[model samples]
Target chain A: MPYVNIKVTREGVTREQKAALIAGVTELLLQVLGKSPALTHVVIEEVELDNWGLGGLSVTAFREQNR
Target chain B: MPYVNIKVTREGVTREQKAALIAGVTELLLQVLGKSPALTHVVIEEVELDNWGLGGLSVTAFREQNR
Candidate 1:
């Protein structure tokens, strides 16, 4: 099975919001990517503040570094 | 940008073979998943014997455990 797992920080999202986002992502993938819902696997890992990064910089540190 | 990175063992594969496999995988994803080659990203990481697992067991350990 080809599974797509997305790991992102959940700083501002609640569980319900996360679920809705996942559902939307799954729907988009199915419609745009043509993947069957049964065969497609989507896993979301919500990382804490200290564990997320972007452009080779941790989110918090990057914000601090920029400030 | 959504990228699909596949990490697998390179125990029995040559460099050329690995490239071929990646190309084949990308093609399959494009045809079967209907993902555009431009937006789709694929990365392959080759793991050594000590760093791989399957069915809750290390590959070598699993083979040994089965014996």
Candidate 2:
């Protein structure tokens, strides 16, 4: 069983986009690893800007400083 | 930064239970990997019984057969 978890800053993700992500990730796994889709699990988690950080700065603050 | 994706067979999981899971997972990462909580991402995905399988049998079918 292959379990894939996708995390993206929750800014403007739409339902359709999520659907596409789920399909695409599953397809990629099947192609690369020959894993069965029936046992493949793709989960997307939307992180709050404040909760996600890079280089020791939260995405929210980083975006603000850049702007 | 550490990203964690938790996939569990979706059956009778409550919102409170999920919250506890998120918190526990985050804490575990911090203790083991010394990852920061601010940048740690934890997402829980609940898989349908039909979508999760073991030994080529879907969880739904496996449960039924065992029952």
Candidate 3:
């Protein structure tokens, strides 16, 4: 069983985009790893800017400092 | 760096439950693998019943069939 988790900043991603991402990732795994689509699970997670961290700082704070 | 993702069907999971899961997982990794807490990332994903599939049927359909 192959389970894939995709994490991104919670930036207004539409349901259509999420569906496409799931389908695309599933297909890629099937093509590359010969995984069965039935056994593949794809999950997308959108994190709030304040919750996601990078370089010891939250994404929101990092962006503020960088910008 | 460790990235852990936990997914379950979108039942009514309270914020406290999610927080407990994240904390419990992160602590487990740190204790078992000696991973750094700062470098550990835990994400919880709640999936809709219709989106999750099992045995060639969506979870919704599978539940209905079983019930």
**Which residue runs does candidate 3 get wrong by more than 4 Å?**
B1-6, B12-45, B48-67
- List, residue by residue over A1-63, the lDDT tens digit for candidate 1: 225554445555466655654554445445443435564455656667567665687768877
In model 2, state the lDDT of residue B35.
Answer: 83
Better of 1 and 3 by DockQ: 3
Give the poorly placed runs of model 1, Cα more than 4 Å off: B1-67
Off by over 4 Å in 2: B1-67
Q: Which one wins on DockQ?
A: 3
Cα lDDT tens digits for candidate 3, B1-67: 9999788989999999998998998899999999998999998878876555444345665578899
DockQ of 3: 0.16
Judge candidate 3 at residue B35 and give its lDDT. 94
Error of 2 at B35 (Å): 24
Please compute the TM-score of chain B alone for each predicted structure, in the order given. Answer: 0.63, 0.91, 0.91
Task: Summarize candidate 2's per-residue lDDT along A1-67 as a digit string, tens digits.
Answer: 7877678898887655666666677778789999897787665667899999998999989989899
Local accuracy of candidate 1 as per-residue lDDT tens digits, B2-21: 34554445465466654664
TM-score of 2: 0.55
TM-score for each predicted model, relative to the true structure = 0.43, 0.55, 0.57
Docking class of 3: incorrect
lDDT of 1 at A46: 60
Ranking by lDDT: 3, 2, 1
